[model samples]
Target: MLRVLAVDDEKPLLEELLYLLRSDPRVRSAEGASDATGALRRITRALEAGPDGDDGIDVVFLDIHMAGLTGLDIARLLAGFARPPLIVFVTAHEGFAVQAFDLKAVDYVLKPVRPERLAEAVRRACAQLGRATEAPAAAAEGPPGGPPGAVPAVPGPPGVPAAHRPAAEVTAADRTPEQIAVELGGVTRFVAIADIAYVEAQGDYARLHTDGGSHLVRIPLSTLEERWAARGFVRIHRRHLVALARIDELRLDAGTTSVRVGSAELQVSRRHARGLRDVLMRQATG
Candidate 1:
């Protein structure tokens, strides 16, 4: 059972989330907060109590806009913590999705939340938590009665024409064949190995931020990392993988470190902090 903490300024929305979360059997316990400050206090108290106390919160559903401190502000504070709960932003606005994804949120659900959508969000949260907590063997097993790597059949004729093939049948090629082509100024530009600075995951697209400028490339961050990890690009965050040479400065704030690359300030998670520091130190001395 996953423990959830949901925060929203609206009283009615908070009540609805509380009720829906409690109704789900998978949710062991749930809590609600009307503002960011209260939510932070609750989270801090919960964390101090450790994982076994008061049904620890595995995920947080945050609203971007609030009266005092915004959800993004709260998220930044939480990111500085030693162990922060997985965040899922729930807001009426779609504009925050890119920034939310950049912050490595589990999911972004729109406002006027439907029961099905909420349930789906919870399901995804559970899956993400399971991936983080469960053993390797348990995670490898397919869903009940399904074989490993098996694809479900679509309701269509067996001998369908190639042109009339199901949309799902078209295989999306991996971006790491040789070199990826990025479009800038309506022209296709091929980014070489040494010139790329970082690759950031923006929902379905990956933004390639290099020395020249940023370009949107249609590729998954995981794919880019797997292909370029040998070429000096390091995965500093779930959303960001940066080139070691592109790092301009590192700032430390209250034991939390932020790396400066161009105009962007990327956060280094506590779990990855030591490794990043070691890498940067080596770069400095060598």
Candidate 2:
């Protein structure tokens, strides 16, 4: 179980956060402060009380834009502590994601919080705190049998037949891929990597396709290929990195080779075709 401190300037939002945190089975206690100063004071008292005491907070769900000593400021101050509580930023702004990650935040969640998404954040905090917990179905389920409902097909790259484009990739092994942060209309949201069907390279950016929708992230395709290789993403084309489990069919048409993923069928480059086939066969047999 985890002890949580939820900090927000707004009373209603703070109360809501405390309520949600208290509702989770993983949380032992939930407390709230309406401003960063009060939050810091409470945290200091808890720290002085020591980890063996009931007052020691394990996590702090902080709001970034408070009036006095902003949440970011508090985080920076706490950084000097020998054992600072885990931080999870809860805010309406998306621009501070890079900074929050730099502070080693457990998660960055947007405001008007969803119960399911907050649960995912809690799970991450637990993992960081070396506590064990089960992930909620909405955030944990993998494909072939994702939460039921027809997924809207992601539109493929331009000039390619939309139905024949590659789907996204996810970790097939025991390790769960870290949630990818996506910025949409100034609001940041996290997309679980397990939900992705395929990846399409777009210059320095890679678009992640999933059942919910596609998200364009600022990362290189080569970078993802290397990072996710152990997780089952393979480079079948210079522009595509696809999940082995999501590949529905392999096709050969008059010496040309292609693979189908979800509703998209992507042409496999000659250089990678043999390797792709070998790996697919290995996966099929195993």
Candidate 3:
């Protein structure tokens, strides 16, 4: 079971975050703070009691942009704790995702928060916490299932020290870029990744442009770029990433280039142009 804390300046969003967190069986309890100050107090007091104590919250779902001290500020301060709680950032923007990831955040969820996304973050946090507690055991056991960065064995063969083994390539084996979760009419909806014609980056989130309509999601463009790169998506501009399959034509004149995706015309920045062309060529060849 996980104890969660949600901090947001807005009452409604705080309440909503707590509600969503509580819906998961893994979440033992969920609480809220209207501001960073209030949250800091709760966290400091909890840390003072030790992480295993009754007051300790196991995971924090923090809002990035807020009055006074920001979520990032709290995260940095909490690093002093002997057993700092897992941090999962929740926000209306995607601009902080990169910075949050640098802090080793459990996950970053853009709002309006989808139940599935929130739940998935909780699952990740739970997994991380489990790993933290099992570290000593893992050191003696040669990792939980197998050596680092490898396809874990069913019962990982005995007595092969993890330190002696060579690190293997990380693969998303059998993975498919499928649907993304979005907020629609106060409910969480999934939009098929294949249906997206293009994606526009919005600070900490991305707006998926499709034939049906645009859906704003908390997923950062960089995150999508890494996940969907193998599936034909390429960054056309800082704010726009396009799927190669969606391009109908590429126009270049006087060092400026533009791509046609259906009826929409999007300018491609010079730095990303070569990479885009390369991906398109590879896609065509394969």
Best by TM-score: 2
lDDT against the true structure, per candidate, is 0.70, 0.75, 0.72
| lDDT (Cα, tens digit) per residue for candidate 2, span 91-183 | 989999999999999999986576667888999988887888774453232212222332332233332222112324222211235665543
CA RMSD of all predictions:
19.1, 17.6, 14.0
Pairs of colliding residues, candidate 2: 164-265, 167-197, 167-198, 168-197, 168-198, 169-198
The candidate maximizing lDDT is 2
lDDT-superior candidate, 1 or 3? 3
Ranking by lDDT: 2, 3, 1
Which pairs clash inside model 1? Answer: none
The residue pairs found clashing in candidate 3 are 93-204, 94-203, 94-204, 94-205, 95-203, 95-204
| Residue 125, candidate 3: C-alpha displacement in angstroms | 0.4
Deviating ranges (above 4 Å) for candidate 3: 131-286
Q: Which ten residues in a row have the lowest lDDT in candidate 2?
A: 158-167
Ranking by TM-score: 2, 3, 1
lDDT assessment of candidate 2: 0.75
In model 2, how large is the Cα lDDT of residue 142?
A: 22
In candidate 3, clashing pairs total 6
